[model samples]
Target: MLYRYGSLIHRRARLVLVIAVLLIAGAAVAGAGVFGRLQGGGFDDPGSESSKAQRLIDERFGGRANLVLLAHATGGSVDAPDAAAAGRDLAAALQREPGVRDVVSYWSAGVPDLRSADGADAIVLAHVDGDATQRRERAGQLIERYAADGPALHVRAGGETAVNLDVNGQVARSLAIAEAIAVPLTLLLLILVFGSVVSALLPLAIGGIAIAGTFAELTALGAVTDVSVFAINLTTALGLGLGIDYALLMVTRFREELGEDRPVAEALATTVATAGRTILFAAGTVATALTALLVFPLYFLRSFAYAGIGVVVIAALGALVVAPALLAVLGRRVNAWPVGRRRASRSAGTAFWARLAGAVMRRPALAALPVVLGLLVVASPLRHVAFGTPDEGVLRPGSAGRQVADRLATGFPSNQNASVDIVLTGPVDRDRLAAYAQQLSTLDDAALVTSSAGTFGHGTRAGEGNPALSRPTGERLTVASRLTAKSDAAQRLVRSIRSAPAPAEAYVGGVDAALIDTTHAIGARLPLGIAIVVLATFVLLFLFTGSVIQPLRALVLNVLGLSAIMGALVWIFQDGHLASWLRFTPRPMDTAMTVLMFVIVFGLSMDYEVFIIGRIAELHGQGMPTDEAVRTGLGRTGRIVSAAAALLAVSFFAFGTGTVSFLQMFGIGCGLAIVVDATLIRGVLVPAILRGLGRLNWYSPAPLRRLHATVALREA
Candidate 1:
């Protein structure tokens, strides 16, 4: 099948090139539309309880959303007239902004109202009827407008508006820095691995086109579906990584064929037949793994899964069709730099691999025991792994959000708290509501509270007809409590409130609230993701190798690799044991990140597995014995596998250099896993096991054997 494709593409190189160009152009045009829709309306649907609450608010409250800003004097009393006046001026200035709907401040509260109910701080609330991006910009302008007069009143803007603006800037900067490192480092690694500037550059160009196209498609899709900002980075990374990997495999095969005395068209055909088919299978596996994320209850995971799958599809097509077409045009030049001594035939039984396998088989217990023990020892730390959401402090210290969050943590609570909604079944007495509200003020973790009844009361209130009655029926009261902490602390507080056995049914909802629900959802569905990936791998390998045991062996080895990687990660980040050397400030791992790592690492590890198995299968077809085939195949593909793994590791590690600790942990963990997988698992362990098994590597049930022979298992 691939031979015909390569032949046709070679014969009509210009036509094939035109098609490639058109596909990319179409994708570009479509991506612009996707971007436009995304800019107009962002998708915030994660389907978590917190998101459900936010949705409820959006549905129940139809007016423009108001962002409250508090500008307090750092060195002066917030009660001073000047401080009060500055707050009023800033509020008025915000009111004049293009998107501003209204402003609420002490000055707007009529005559002589200059202090908050607490009498310690003044407040300014700005209302904006706009998208999140516009709201953030308006907040930025407010900061600039009040800058000169701020210090005189010790004015520091701290509110949802300020925090959102700061967080947006931080996310943008982190992405920019991650990409800045990822791109150049990717190119350098390609150049080294391909040993040719042109080949290295080729994949980047193809990947760039794919990304542009994917973005265009995503933008178009955004018109119908919500595309988060995070999707952009996901698409870029997926497109680039897969693009390079696919093209390199084909190019390597094409070069080898040419060296073996095949003509340009024939070499292209062979390359397509072999490497192209393999690329398809590899991408199919990756896409399948990513698609499992759609089962997640959160839109965040679903969005990532879809975008990643799109990139992988585009990358696979580029390598299978576009790359071969391009190769046909520059066939000989693709391998202009000749590698010496091309060996056409491999022996039936190789000495080194045979001996190595014998050694492993002879000491199977010794060899397997030590490796398994080592992995377990590394994995031990995960028993104590604590999960938490990332804080702004994980960003660079110079970041505005980090500085603000740090200040807030010091002055307020630990930064993990949420704005809660406490609803009552029936409410009639304003004084009783006020009494319950006063109790909220006395809670140890409550740094601040905002309520409809003016002030919160102390201690729990219990009465038959009280607004604090614990019921989920009509006529409810709501209170928004800003807690001191962010992730776990907020989660604990929410649990505490719900578990208090109080009369009123309380519902806490915020980012922390959303994360808690999302984390629970992730834990519930994570096993499904593993099962999906494993099932897909089994099917792919069973068809490719015609052996059940071989597939099972690969699965076992992959599990070991994952355990080792995760164990090491828990040891470093969870335990805070390696904070000094790695320059990492340990924070709890986001639940989503941990699950993401499992999918990504497993899919990537499959790349090496497939590559090795393909080479072995090829040699076996040429009549090499099982032992000789394993050795010879390893020798042939080892360099490429090692180089590819190294390049992938370097690309991932580049992300670690960014200010986001989550990205850093991801990079380091995956990077370390790849190094271990390529060397320890694929290189040492698999060979040792295969040596013991001998012809068992080819063993399969008669029915399966017949099916495998029918399929032919030709990847390219």
Candidate 2:
């Protein structure tokens, strides 16, 4: 099938080139709007209990106060006449803004909690009305309008919405920086690998086409659904990385076939029949692994899945269709300006890779044990893994939102925005609500609890007769206790509130509650996500290799490699070992980012696995002994796999240069996993394990064998 497609493309090369040009042009135009269309945040699960509570609060209490403007007095306490007057004016102006609501400040409400501990700063808190995206937009404008240094006071915008805006901006800058570094470095490495400037440029061209198509597709997807701005980083990295990978394989095979003195069309056909088939299988595996993220409810995870699948499909098409047409046109000139002697067709049982494979085959168990143990030792830090949601701290240290968060954490008694909201439905009276508030105040971690009846601290009423604590409709009352997001104390406080008796049906909603709920939602669906990935991978690999065992082995090896990568992320990011070097604050790794890395790394590991094993399987089918097949296959494909993995690793590492911790985690984690998989696992463990299994590596139950043959890809 690929041979026929390649033949048709070769025969119609000019037409294909013209169509490619047209598609690229259209894609570039359509994709230009992608950044503007994407959303800034998607960390919450809409159907979770916390979400329901948040909705009720918004409906009854005018939404959660998710925006904060901190006003710092220039010389004295905020009560100084000049600072007080400026703060009051700023608060009043904010209240008049179209989307701002419930603006509260020390000057407006005389609430002590709104004042900083030192009395030199005060907070104006308000809710930005709209969905997440709209709220971020409004917050951006408000920051521009209000965040400034006046003679009396200095004001800075900080809150969930503001943090999201900062995060989105940093990600954009990081993407630009990553591309600027990666593209040229990738070109240099490609030239070194292919030893021809002409050959080196093809992959970048294919990558550009794939990236253009991916952005255009993402823009279109954003029109119908929520797509996280974070997906853009993945699209850029994978589109270029995988595009180069597939194109390198095809170009290398074409060059080899041409080296054998085959006619251009025939060489192209043979190249497509072999390397093209591998690309299809590799793309399928990658897409399947990413598609597993669809089981997750968060748009953050789902967005990557969408972007990943789109890039894989587009990259594959570019390599299969556009790359071949380019290759057909280039012909012998593909190797023009070669830097070194061009590699001839690989000979069996002779090359350095073959010799290494033989040495490992001679001592399979001895060779395998240390690599496995070494990887396990590296992965040991996962035992201490801690999960947390990303916040303003995920941004760089001096970023506006992060600076605000740092100040708030240090100056305020507690984070009001991170407060736990206790919603009481079917409440009877003030006395009952007071009793509930008293119970909440008794918890060791609860700083204060506010209700309609009074404000309680340490189980005592600190104040009374606060009407603003209750909804005007009078059927609901809100009890708020300040807490930190994702801290153990906050999590414990949430549990206490839920288990404590209340005057009415109680629901807990706040940053802490939302964090707990989001974690649970991901955990609940995790098994299913793993199942989908595993089952899909098994089926796909069985069809590709006609052996169930090889697929199972692939999964095992991938898990080992992924374990080390996850452990390294925890050790470096979470444990703060590399915090100074990486320039990120020490915090628990984001749960969603961790899961994303797992699925993506698994898919990419399978990508290299298929390329190498498929070659070995083909050699075995041609009657080579198992050892000879392994050696010959590794000899033939080892350079290509290493080159592809290096290119991909460089792309991911470039993204690691990003200031955001989320991007850094992805960039470093994926890059390390690719390099480790390509060298340690693929080079050492795979050959050793297969050599130990010998002919059994190809064994399957008779019934399954027949089933596999029916689905297995056949060479022309």
Candidate 3:
């Protein structure tokens, strides 16, 4: 089947090239506006109780204020006549902005929560009304207008909306920085690997085309759904990494076939038949693994699935379709501009990989023991792993949103923005609601609670005249508690309030409650996502290798490699070991990022495994002994896998230069995993295990073998 497709593509190489160029041009045009349409955050599960409560609060009571302008009295106290006048003027000016609503300030509202603890500063709170994109756009404009120093007061913009805007800006900047570093570094490394300028440039060209196509797909996806801006990072990294991976494999195979003096058509056919099949299975594994993320309710994760799957599909097409056309057209000219040394003759059987594989096969147990033990030792830090959601802390230090968050954390009496909102449905009993609010305020974690009766502090009613605290619309009344979002204290407080008695059916909502519910949602569905990825991978590998054990082995090794990577992430990012060097404040690893890394790394590990083991299986089918097949296959494919892994690692490592902690974690973790997988797992352990397994590596039940045979992936 691959040969037939290759023939058809080669026969119409010029036409295929024209079509590929035109498609890329169209994709570039369609994708030009994607960044502006992407969302900054989608970490909440809309179906959860917290989400419902939030919806009720928005529809019934006024929606939450997501923008805060901090006003600092530079010359005197904010209550001083001049500073107070400036604060009021700024508040009134913000209220006039098109998208700004629910504006409140200490000078206008006389609310103590709006006043800073020291009295020298005050907050102007407002709601940025619109969808995610609109809110961010407005927040940007507001920051430009309001975040400036005046004679009496210095104003700075912040809050959830401001944080979103900052995050969007950072993502865009990081994408540019990562691409800048990745492109040139990747080209240099590819030149070193291929030792030919033409060969090196082909993979980058394919990668560029794949990225353009992926951006177009993401733009379309963003219009209909809440696609996260972070997905662009994934799209760029995966597009380049996988595009180069597939191209490298195909190009290397084509070069080898040509070295054997085969005609251009025959070499292209042979290359596609072997490497093309592997690329198909590899792409399938990656797409299936990423598809498991769809089980997550958070679009933050699901967005990656969308981007990853799209890039994998596009990268594969570039390799199988566009790359083959290019190779057929270039022929031996692909090797022009050779660098350093002429391409070495692999038939000499003196390659370093063959010798290394032979040594491992001769002492399988000795070779494998240290590699396994070393991986376990490196993975030990996972025992202390903690999970949390990203917040303003994810922003770089000294950023506008980070500055506001730091000030809020230190200067405010309590974070009203992080307050947990308890919604009561069904009946309005003022006394019962007041009693519930009192109970909430009495909890050690709760600083205060507000309800229709009044605001209560530590179970005592502080005041009762605030109209915003009273619900005049319907049976629903909101009781808000002062608790930090995504904190352990806040999580405990949410649970306590949910369990506390109330006059009606109560649902808790706020940043804290949303995070708690999101955590649960992930835990609830994680097992199913893992099951889908594992089962699908098992089936795919079974069809590819006609063996059950090989798939299981692949799973085990991939897990070990990924576990070590996760452990390193926890040690460096979560444990704060490299906080200064990485330039990120340490916190728990983002739960969604952890899951994303696992699925993505597992699938990519399988990708390299398929390439290595498929060749081994082919050689074994050609009457070579198991040990010999392992050595020969490793010798032939080892350099390709190493070069591909290096290119992929470079792509991810570029993200390490990013400012966001989560993106840094992703960049460093995946880059380390690729390096470790290619070296320790693929180089030493896999060869040793194959030697130990011997004939058992191909063992399968008769019924399963028949099923596998029916669907077996042919290797030329």
Model 1 poorest ten-residue lDDT run: 340-349
TM-score of each: 0.85, 0.97, 0.97
Over the stretch 1-716, how does candidate 2's per-residue lDDT look in tens digits?
88898899899999999988998999999999999889887788989878888888888888878888989899788999989999999999999999889888889888788888999899999999997678877988999999999999999988888988888888898999999999999999898888789999999999998899999999999999999999999999999999999999999889889988999999999999999999999999999999989999999999999999999999999999999999999988999887764454233212767788888999999999999999999999999898888888798878878877777776787777667887776545777878878888898778778778888888888886467658744333334445556788888888888899877777788778888988998999999999999999999998888887999999999999999999888899999898898898889989999999999999999999988998999899898999999998998788888889999999999977888998899999999999999989999999999988877898889999888778777766
Question: Whole-model Cα lDDT per candidate?
Answer: 0.66, 0.88, 0.88
Give one digit per residue, the lDDT tens place, for model 1 in 578-636: 77766666777766667777887888888788888888877887899877787777776
Sort every candidate by TM-score, greatest first.
3, 2, 1
Q: What is the lDDT of residue 313 in candidate 1?
A: 85
Query: Stretches of candidate 3 above 4 Å error?
Result: 344-350, 472-484
As a TM-score, model 3 comes out at 0.97
Which model is ahead, 1 or 2, in terms of lDDT? Answer: 2
**How many collisions per candidate?**
32, 0, 0
Deviation in Å, model 1, residue 407 alpha carbon? 2.8
Model 2 bad stretches (over 4 Å)? 340-350, 426-428, 472-483
| True-structure RMSD for candidate 3 | 1.7
Candidate 1 lDDT score at position 339: 34
